[model samples]
Target chain A: MNWDYLLSLFMGGLTRGSIYALIALGYTMVYGIITLINFAHGEIYMIGAFTALIAIGVLTLAGWNGTAILLIAAVAAVVYAAAYGWTLERIAYRPLRHAPRLSALISAIGMSLFLQNYVRMAQTANFLPFPNLIPEFAFLKPVAHIVRSSELVIYAVTALVMLLLTLLVRFTRMGKAMRATAQDRDMAMLSGVDVDRVISLTFVIGSAIAATGGVLIASHIGQINFYIGFLAGIKAFVAAVLGGIGSLPGAVLGGLVLGWTESFFTGYVSSDYEDVFAFLFLVGILIFRPSGLLGRKQMEKV
Target chain B: MKAEFKKSLLAALWFMFLTFPITVVRVNTIERTVAWRWERLIWIGAATFILSFIWRRLLHRKQTGRREVSAGEVRPPSRWKQMAADPRLKGLALSAAALCFLVIPLLFSWNKTILVTNALIYVVIALGLNIVVGLAGQLVLGYVAFFAVGAYSYALLNYHFAVGFWAALPMGAALAAAFGLLLGFPVLRLRGDYLAIVTLGFGEIIRIVLENWNALSFGPSGIDNIPPPGFFGLALTLRQTHIAIYYLMVALTLLTILVVHRLQHSRIGRSWEALREDETAAQAMGIDTTGAKLSAFALGACWAGMAGVVFAAKQKFINPGNFTIWESILVLCIVVLGGMGSIAGVVLAALVLVILPEALRVFADYRWLLFGALLVLMMVFRPGGLVNARRRAYAFEPSAPEKSERP
Candidate 1:
């Protein structure tokens, strides 16, 4: 094996997986609470990228540079995405909450369609170049041999975010409320938890995290497009399912595994068949172990 | 009632205000310039008029506080159905309806005939989908893949082996049915949203294969110059051919309705209904859930295949692009908006959904946007559908309740 080539591929996969993990976190969190799938979550990510791209463009034009531009862009994307997520819940979901499961799903599908077309109409169809924030890794030639500085930055940021999330969910009162709500909505309500507020906050948090992922990915890939969300959403959904939907750490693990599989499969096999591999993996897991690798077996209510 | 009216009106106005930016401001991507679509004002006007009319007509009826019940036992007929279902005039109305169906196409201009033909084609597909989505309660987002399979089977057979349309029709449908069984076997164990996403993935895979396999599917540019079906070995001119095909589509639609309606009352159909209402309980009740699900998938695919064969014959061409995810969404909308399991509802939905956007060519750009909004709004307001299916009580007439109860 060419160690250098494998090392680079692994690095690339890790970067990609970090973003997938971010996106999958949103899906898994929402599914944990309501089990709605949130089909429009991908569009939230896309909107994040767009919002970040515009922020960066404006900031750079106004003479902002380097880390400052990235900071502002990241904040802008997360805020915009959180707002979008909250509105989505309020409009597309809240009314249909008591309706049939199929109806809410159909409504979600409609929301997905509307958002896709809305972005397609609002933005150019073609991919727009994203501003590159990372400096040339000329200074890191000694320590970083195979991986670039940008890749390291991605890893560090992802690790920091994950740590922050773990701390929040483990220690914070609001996080406990979210957890209580996710466990049982009616019980949580009975216990005086603001279930509605918890759900809304979950959406806001998930969208913000996904937006951070989206901005980072846009910067890494060097371009953004309207339709990227659909496929990426599907793949990340597969990741969430792979790890055990509703399990946060499981989502992260699944994302990494999915990313590795894609990288290795593309290196050895046909890149065209990579998506097929992800879905096939999903089917294989679901057939043999429906609860996923980490998910607890849930009993169906009579 | 007055407060309720005011609340609903205020809600509508709020909704109107929220959507105003989207309605009036449209970005022209090609020019990279933003412009106002002032034409949306006309739509706003029309919408307010319709809303006011509905408020008056429907709310006024509600205010009367009338039961209009036949007996206290039977399920109350919706106001529209009650008006249409007079016992003395039932036979006369049935005959009139049949007469209208028979003569309507003949009265139609050529363009309208084409539109009707398209609607009939969707009607058949939607009815097929109704079996799976409505009766079985399985959301198959990839339903169009079966349609594509049938179309391609007919086209490939004709292109490769000189098979005629008549011979290929049943063969195409059988092939699609087999494919359905193939898909059903693996997916039978899954349910609900999991089943939905997996099927969606399968559908995408199928499309990608169809698009990528150049040697087999002609690589998405599509098969062209497919021969239309012959009427009893008669070779007619183009105009005559279109008319003949329209009639053929009509015949096929009637045949589908007959089959689906018959099956809806059959033992298997009851099994499907049982399963749909509650799969675990139905299985506990000795219904073969697997068999019911597989049958629903196969039968639904069978009709879609028939529609596909006709589609290939009518258009005289076929492509992977023609069988897109959007087509699946379109057919699902028809079944849903028409009321899930109602035949008449499906027909009406097919007509309105298929013909309305075409008629409103000025708002063609907003077609899908409106459709998306419609799906959300319908789910919120009328999840049961415009003409939701009502369970028939006559099926239990043998052991009817001794006393009628009023709600």
Candidate 2:
């Protein structure tokens, strides 16, 4: 491939990877803390996108500036998604904690189905064009390649969010509590951590990040749909697993790897099999390193 | 004997009572237009529901005395005894009777071959899935990948090498198995949901490849007019030789079931179960966990490949759309609802899952809703499955001399 084309592909992959990484953080965090896949996290993202879409639409109808409207929409979507995440855990997952892993998984699947179909029923099962929130501007014009202002915005926002999340987990008391709970729930509880509250907060934070990713993705893609979550959810989950499912940094790395793989596959081979290439990469990673790149392998008790 | 006779008589009476209104509705609807059939159908359904409720209540009352007599003697039955005492013989007898009933219709029918052929195709898919999910305890969400591989392999070979169906069949299976090996390597480290997601991704990738690889897969338009299997000098076409294809499908299905059954009871099967029950324990027991898991994937993929060949021949066309995630989910549902690890359960499930939707064609729009509801209900009520495998019981008895140790 030509350098210019390669450069564009690289940029595209990076931008897309950033979004995947953002969404994947949510998966990694929830999995780290509760060992649940949080299957509905993608739906939470979908809700966030829709929430932003609605918020923007309403604001624009009320004659608000595009920048001001986007800011409000982002905040509203994150808060709404966080609340939704909190309620979802309380209602579907909390009681099932003592149940088998499979039961919780099935419940998660149920919640996913309920949310997806509920959205399908509520909204028309078609892609709704997301209005351009950020104006298009060329960041890199030297190589005849242009980066949209939206892409730059998404990358910056995602990086900022990731940085904030890292700090929150590393430095905050609640973050330490979450880490403790994740290590051993019983011990965490014994240590006077409100394990339940910590878990709920984890979901809340994860959902908020996912919501942000969703809005960014919607804007980047310029369209949103009810079924968008299905593939993205799986991919994000793959990213989580690839990075070492429970590790935050691993998720970001996995997401970038996946995004790069897809971009290269599409660039070199064909766009049609982009999904296939990505999965093959995932499968390859799993075979060689089951613990993922950054994940620690645990010995199963016989 | 007298009580048995009375119970049989009552059951027959109840059956006739429920059937009477349905017959009446059918007769009445014959004079009216077919559009009004729904109204009559509703009325008949209501009547049947009421009759069944009353019959169940009466049966419940009569069973109370027998319950008291059998109280305090609840002991587990031996596996052999349980198998021998199974009431499925009546179902077999009923099927035999139904076959006889259909004999005259078959002679006069034109679509007999198609119905049987379709059933056999489903049987193949079910049996293939049984090897993966049922025998191995590995949840594969993108089984359609193998199916697609088989179909496309056949298409490419037929077009390029001019290989006939028989040659393509083995080639297709081999190709799918190769892909399975490729997939199994990475996913060997992953378990359950992680493996499932990867497999799902693999499937979508395959589909997208089929859609985008225009030179090979012909993109989304797919390969058309796929040639049927030619045995010796005879060409098996859908029109004149539909019965031959039907028999071919039946033979293939039988072969699939036999292989699956054999594999399920083999050492490999035991290893799979060991891994499923406790992977670490299996590994500790000297089982090569990676090899076992790969074998599961390869074998499962091989069967799916064979099914794909059959599907292509039956349809005389192959398209990417035919292999979708929903199709994979449906197959997964079949294995789950059929009772995991039980061959008979999977077969029964496949039949019901396929036939029920066909039977409910009139309620087409509500089919998915009903299917989803049934899945949720089944998981809720009998998550183990309809014919849950009996748990192996230990023949442990407290020794009189050892009793003081606990005290």
Candidate 3:
């Protein structure tokens, strides 16, 4: 049994899962509150990566060093992504709050398309090379074959983000408001919670996390284009659904499960049908457990 | 008005900030070059400034219109609605539209004929999708998979066994229906959003399989040189063939419209409508919700299959690229923008969406961007779509005042 090969695949899955979890967090959080799938969430991630690239390019031209450029670019990505998310909710989604569920979904889809084209038109359609910002660490030379230094960073950052998010959701006054809104929006509004503000904040927080993931993944993958968000968004959404969409832990677990499944399948089986396998897994999960693994079974109110 | 101007100004400024990174900075990492596009910033600022004012005005008007309605103000019927209600005008409009359809193709060049023919094909496909989404209320994101199935079935069968178009049409449709049932059966139990994702997944699976499974699908380069439908085995020239396809599409489109109209009035159609409104209520009313949903999928898939076969014949080639999720979205946009469940609306939308792009080739780059914006704006401002399907009205007359009964 090739233990080393298995270990490498495991690490690969972990890295991939971390990225998925970051994006899925946004989808789950937004869906938890509004019950509207923010289709443009993926586009926010794309925008983040593009923003980071632009920042890096400008900083490099200004003769900045590596670490400072990375830091500023990441910050720029997060801020811009959060802004885009907040604005998107206001423009495309807010007016449709009183409308039918399908209307919001369509609008979300439209926003996604619009954003994708906006990037394509503003930038280039060809793949832009994402610079690898994370340097190789000399300390883990022996186990370097199993896991790259960047993968370790991704895991650590994802863990830290999750911990921070959990703390925010559990302890803060705003967190309490968000919880109330998610539980029952009308009740929350009546109880003096600003529902609109809470919803916008959720989008902001989600988009910020997704941007972090976008920046990290783009660096890892070494290339990005206008269309990366669509597939990634779909996969992340799938992971969120697998985890039982409204549940944060469920999203993380789902991401890990999906990432592992994809990595192992591609590692062992033919890589040609990797996407097919992921999609089939989604279908199977949806068919068997519609509410998801961690999602509570919602009662149909009479 | 002053407040509105201030808001628009704020919006314009916000847009300028939002667009700074993408619009202002162009980075080519491979060449290590940074191109600063300052003009784009100006363009964004200008566009947003003007658009914001228009947007605010429309929103204000919409709000006022809603307020008037809520306040019990009796608004007169719109001119279009009144014209539609008048039999004389309706007949005149119908005949004029028919005359245009008949005369325009003959006057058009081969490219124009092909474009119109494609539009006609979409009209059929859109009507099919209307059955599932508009009528049955199931959002199948992978609707294009069935279309692909039909196309591939025809393509492969013709390539292997020399099966002609006439022989392949029914076979293609049946195969597509089978595939629809295959997808619909498992997903029947899921809710709307979940169903959408699963269908999307199913679509990707189909595409990936087609692209990878070289032994079966010819692997992405696609099947080509597939002959157009034979007119008694006569070798028609390219222009003649295109004209034939156009006429064929016209005939098929008419058939689809007639069938869809009939279905909309049928018992099954009512069940679909009921299912769409509220599944639980529909089920409580003894409508087999499952059956209705499944039938919608099968029937919708059947039409897509027919259209797919025709699409293959028209193009004389079949590839995975022709049946992407975007194609499904395009058909969906027609069903939606035209007004769900409205046969005439679907036809009109299909014509406009398909033909408008070809007609306005200069705005090709901004097409998808505008489409996305249009979808959002439509949802925000006009959720009922361009033409709301007229609801059935029945008048209840009180024959006489029952004074004795009241006493």
Candidate 4:
């Protein structure tokens, strides 16, 4: 492959992978803390996209400019998604904490189905065009033909959010509580940390980040459907696992790897076999290193 | 107050029933016929309920003089005490087995050959899933991926290579098993929900490949005119004769059941149970946990492959949509509802799941609602399944010379 073309492809993969990484963090965080896969996270992403779409529509109706509309929509999407995520955990998952894992999984599946079909029923099954809120500036026009201004915006937004998340996790008191609860819920409870609150807060933060990713993806793609999250969610989950399920930075690394592999497979081989390649890679990694690249191998207590 | 509550409830039901027709008449022709029939059925159902209540009361009054016995408790028989004392319960079970062998085929109408064939197909799938979910305790969400592989393998091989059905059958199973091994290598380490998520991803990936791969899968139009099985020189197709296919399916189903039953009682089965109960302990016990897990995956996929070939032959049309996530979930539901490790339970569960929907065609829209409710209720009340697998007692006999040892 030509070096320039390969470089561009790599960059493209990184951009896409960053979005997946953001979503994967949500999965990894929840799994790390409670050992539960927040199956409804995908729907939270969907809700985020819709929230942005609605926000854009309302802003446009009131004759807001592109910049103002984008800012307003992003904030609204994050807030709405965070609230929805919190509510879903409270209603569907909270009561089932003491129940069997199978029951919780079933309930999660049910909630996912309900959310997906509900959206399908409310909105037309067809893809709706996202608002062109981000302006196209020629800042990167000299460097490459492939990189669009919209893509640059996506990269910037993702980087900013990730930085903020890192800072929050590293320094904040709430973050400490969240980390403590994740390490050992019983111990955290004994130490005066409200485990339930920490868990809820974890969901809210993760969902907010996922929502941000959703908005960026929608803005980049220009159009989105109700079922868009199904594949992306799976890929993100893969990314989370590949990066070591509970590790934050691992999610990012796994996302990037997955994205690059997918992009390269589609670019060189066939788009049809893109998933085949990705899963094959996953299987290979899992067999060789079950703890993932950065994850510590957990020992089971009998 | 109870009597008044009952009367008011009855009045409310009656009023609603009467209003249902006027509402239907106001709508279109299709709506009217459906509504009218449903309302009339409700009225007839109420009358039957009243009659049954009266009959039950009379029966209870007539039987008042009889001694009452506790529910599900039976008195020991004096005549058969010697046989019953064996403790194995095998002697007691032979009669039930004989009754089942005689009644099942005769009780149901044989005219619905298609239903029997479908049930057989489900039985095969249930057995296949039983290995992964029941034996291995690995929750697989993309089981239909193997089925699709098997179907497509047959279709592609038969059409391009001009291979016969018999040749394609084993080839298809092998191909699916290979994929299962491939998927299992990475995911075998993950447990519970994590494993489930990965498998779900795998299933979606397979479907997406099938959908987008225009060169191979023909992209949505799907492969048609898949040839039927020909034994020796006789060509057996759905159009010519369904009985042959029905018999073939039944034979295959029985073979599957027998194999699974044997496997469950075998050393390998014990290993699987060990893994399910405690993977660490099983590993400590010198069981090759990884190998056992992979075997379960391979075996499960192999069964799914066999079922897929049957499905493709029966339909004579194979497509990506045919093997979907929903189908996988349905198979999983059958296994769970049937009581995971029990063969007879899954068969019965499959029968109910398949037959119930067909029976409730009139209320098609509400069928899923009913199913959802039933699932919740079943999990709540009868989570162990209809026929639970109880522990078999030892058949050892006690000697009558304990006084010598004491002395």
Best by DockQ: 3
TM-score (all chains, Cα) for each model? 0.88, 0.77, 0.97, 0.76
User: Best candidate, TM-score-wise?
Assistant: 3
lDDT of 2 by residue, A1-302 (tens): 38767877887888878888988999999998888888788988987887777667656665777588989989988887887788678656775676445545655665666666655654447787788887656544453354667778888997898899999999999999999998989999999999999999999999999999999889888898888887788788878888998999999998888887777778877775566666776777777787898999967644
Evaluate residue A301 in candidate 1 and report its C-alpha lDDT on the 0 to 100 scale: 79
- Which pairs of residues have clashing backbones in candidate 3? none
How does chain A of every candidate compare to the true chain A by TM-score?
0.96, 0.96, 0.98, 0.96
Query: Which predicted model would earn the best lDDT?
Result: 3
DockQ of each: 0.37, 0.12, 0.82, 0.11
* Global local distance difference test of model 2: 0.75
Relative to the true structure, candidate 4 reaches a TM of 0.76
Per-residue alpha-carbon lDDT of candidate 1 for residues B197-303, written as tens digits (9 for 90 to 100): 88777777778788878899898899999999989988898878888888888788889989999998899998988887889999999999999999999999988
Candidate 3 lDDT over A190-298, as tens digits, reads 9999999999999999999999999999988889999999999999998999999899999999999999989999999979998888788888887788789999988
lDDT of 2 at B372: 47
Which scores better on TM-score, 2 or 3?
A: 3
Question: Per-residue CA lDDT of candidate 4, range A129-170, in tens?
Answer: 786677778677686467777778878877887788788888
True contacts kept of each: 0.38, 0.24, 0.84, 0.17
Comparing only chain B with the true structure, the TM-scores of all models are 0.82, 0.73, 0.94, 0.73
Candidate 4, residue B372: the lDDT equals 40
Instruction: Write the residue-wise lDDT of candidate 1 on A7-26 in tens digits.
Output: 87888889878888899999
Model 2: which residue pairs collide?
A: A243-A250, A276-B205, A283-B186, A286-B186, A287-B185, A287-B186
